[model samples]
Target chain A: MGLKKISDNTYEIFEEGMNVPARIFASKKILESVEKDRTIEQIKNVAKLPGILKYALALPDAHQGYGFPIGGVAAFDMDKGIISPGGVGYDINCSVRLLKTNLKKEDILKKQKEVVEELYRKIPSGVGRGSRLQITRKELNNILEGGAKYIVEKMKMGKTEDYLHMEEEGCMEDADSKKVSERAMNRGIGQLGTIGAGNHFLEVQYVDEIFDEKVAKSFGIKKGQVTIMIHCGSRGLGHQVASDYIQMMEKEYGFQNLPDRELINAPIKSRLGKDYYSAMCAAANFAFANKQIITHWVREELVRIFPKVKIDVVYDVCHNIAKFEEQIIDGKKRKICIHRKGATRAFGPGRKEIPEAYRKIGQPVIIPGSMGTASYLLVGTKKSEEISFGSTVHGAGRVASRSEALREIKGEDIKKEMNEEGIEVKAGSWKSLAEEAPEAYKDIDEVARVVDELGISKKVARLKPLVVIKG
Target chain B: MKFKFLEHTADVKFQAFGKNEEEVFENSADALKEAICDKKKIKAAEKKDITVEGGDYESLLYKFLEEIIYLLEAEDFLISKVKEIKIKNFRLKAVLSGDKASDYNFNNEVKAVTYNEMFVKKIKNEWVAQVVLDV
Candidate 1:
């Protein structure tokens, strides 16, 4: 049967195979577009998973992934639910952190090239760039155990305020370094603070418009004010862990006659599940520490270039990662594991988990757009908790494949276009740049409109890129 | 090109074809090496023997590509070619030759090899394997 429209911004499918209804949170335009893609099929597959709570929901940026859609969110019963490596993805805690700078766009317009070049040098980019700072295995383990605190509290590379603005305060207590395998550790040790390739980037932007004055002010964002956004994650370590667990889960669960092998999962209460959970947390912790170190390097680069500029991070939000939380399900408050793949946790105001500073306003949800597009800074709302499981879109999801992009768009041409638009572009190669061309992505403005209309997130400010450093 | 790199919306996908199963595996390694850097610039300065056993041909291919990825990320080894590959009952052994990544320029940082839509089957007279690597 064809999917039914729940609202102007919501649609649902109740097919025979689905254990629960699958929902899509997008406007009429996005819903129609997604129908033509593989997103709906993936969402239906997720709905058929065992013990899923409510519905399998996809955000406006939803796209077909290995198992779950990229912008997918699914909450499962703590006791009856299952945990899969595909839910968390390869790059655990792949997130974006935005820093507010005292400088204005006018101040950095002419110096964009110099600043980007310095940042390009200061922070390593591309594949195999290696770790910017060499840390012994002991220190890496401490990072895995301590999260961002290893950089801020112990190493003194950043301030406590940085940790406060991060989701989960940059430390996940469930992290057990012992659960992390030797291969994962070996892959992780030398890749910290380096931005890996394939859609990962570091962009310098400025607040182009303020939609909500109070919320923007609370976020320390002002019109024309400059900011830096780091997009990265646990890199090699997280990937290794995911690879290790996918094999383990399939072995334990017996992947006989599954819809997809990538959808292999284990019951959350199983030993394999517990081991994967701890290992995932440890890798997530590494991501937090990884971003912290990159922040340190970013700060240093800005200081070296613009000596008087002071930048403070507004918020850091992870798009990937699963978390344990309590939610009202079937009229009962039940603990559940929410797996947000290519989706962000958007806890509205008054949620106890939100930082005290943002408790009155809402949790900051940073949604970075594709290259040369307008990004958005938003906040969670009560409506989000009522509808979505406190989750929102991560970015303007890719609409075109890399091969199609290369065939249609040329890197040098797009780079020149960005330059004409007053955006400084830096990358390992121009060929890589074409694959991430702005044309390859969906209309972020349309995605923003859907979320704003759905009340899952409310827009506070919009950012336009000034300098982009692609990995 | 022994292998053609297909485009997924998000990740890097490839299909390698060979007359035999062993050549398909070798071509897959070549595709992975080309993903990292310009394979022509890479020298066969180092050689390592590798053995992998999987539940099936699909698992064997996944494990084999995963091992190649692990070597690149952990040991900084860039594979230029695979030789003397013997495949029997889902157990495969081969010798990989390449140089240290530090000695050459890097093009892409491939994170993990995934089994999503992955297959190893005979199409007509050729053996073809489709893969997707998460970067």
Candidate 2:
């Protein structure tokens, strides 16, 4: 457990077994809290994995997860390394989407409760909740392969411009539905527009503060302008994909040699690895389609309420995923498999992956806060690419368990508190609300400050929740 | 007590107790049931049979619990009771009973079952199993 303070808000641990050093990007205060869990040990173990390049890194919001720490980020040699479902997490492509609106804060304030209620009623959420729009088995396959493009072009759900602002343009070309399991397809068929529970939410927020006027303007943001934030994933489809692949990998390659059973992986060149990657891409596509349909629903509901409101996609980012991308490593450009679990890809300016309009400013990194906290809009910086492989924290990582949160706070009380703060909140159940209380997570302001100070992702604006609809 | 929740930093963890493997597996289902909704309110209106195999007790338990999750999500079935379970060698067979999920209100969602910190074994005379679920 020997960790050296390598630089300001950066720590490194290189040990005997680890093939590469484990680096953690955290302020001193954040590092203290991070060490309280198994995050350090998990990242250290990740460093020892086969073919790991650069270093196993943890963002500021690092917390203990099943295999990889929630905020863990690592890149591996494409041919020499491995692909693990655990590294990508259970909810594949569990991501965030931001929508900019022409309406102002005052426009929503007058009808905040009605707005939240309409959204909660329109969007399908909670456990076992199916979408209002159902698709055939064949249609589900199309979505799995097409992602947001299918929803827009074939289904006529959203605009083509909508997917343009998303990562991978809302589709990962590697997706192949033939590689996905029937069980996963069955689970996804009915969940296209639904937002499954456990930290997933649709929040109506407004820009409260802007740190950089130029970047904020470029991203179509202004103080007091309203916005919609959708946080969800592939739902049961992604969950099934992860479980199916994990079990498949376990059967193919015994976990006796792995550091952790959940850390089970397959060589990148293996058939199982390629199959899992394709299946994972298919699931990620499903998630993209899920959010796209939800966006359409939100637009329909909002227009019914206020005909003048104009909402457009700001940016969308996948927090949990693995991708093969070319990056400069140790003075050499190489294609590596990068797994980002509870981390955001904050590619700096001029990276081809970023959307064309915002290429000069860099990728828009949307880091959402816990329920009833301030979310931040950030821009990726060159420093992040040089030090942490172009990644940043995803959110205010959980500080307490669900049982602890439930025992300590009542959901009704949280609702009352939020109401008193002038934020309208609606949920399917009170228990889930209590489990996701802002108290259960780290201070998002501090988490944002640490990354901004580290020069990984510079803060562009801060958004305050006005209406929250939790799944 | 059949099962009780344990502390974990980010997800749901529970430990189930029984006199043998079969009982422990049943209690584990009960734990999962409670995680989703109040089992007491669920009516055994329907029944489904589940058969799964694994290489060991741990994998067997994982498969069993994962099957229940699949039933809940894919089939929209809310399991109230583990009507019966039989473990032979590395395979498991069980009968579960519950009502449609749409007919009930779920308190939480069990996203997936993880092998992380999962165990099933005998301690002295009491059979025990520990599971951490992704929520």
Q: Could you tell me how far off, in angstroms, the CA of residue A378 lies in candidate 1 after the best superposition? A: 0.1
- Listed in order, the DockQ scores are 0.73, 0.83
Indicate the residue-level lDDT of A69 in model 2: 91
How many residue pairs of model 1 clash at the backbone? Answer: 0
A161-251 in candidate 1: lDDT tens per residue?
9988898889898999998999999999999888888888899999999999999999888899998898999999999999999988887
Model 2 spans > 4 angstroms off: none
RMSD in Å for model 1: 1.4
Q: What are the runs in model 1 whose C-alpha is more than 4 Å off? A: B38-40
**In terms of docking quality, how is candidate 2 classified?**
high
lDDT of 1 by residue, B36-127 (tens): 67445678899989999998899899999999999988999888889679999999999998888777766677888988889999999999
Span of 10 residues, lowest total lDDT, candidate 1 chain A: A28-37
* Residue-level lDDT tens digits of model 2 in A346-388: 9999999999989999999999999999999999998888877
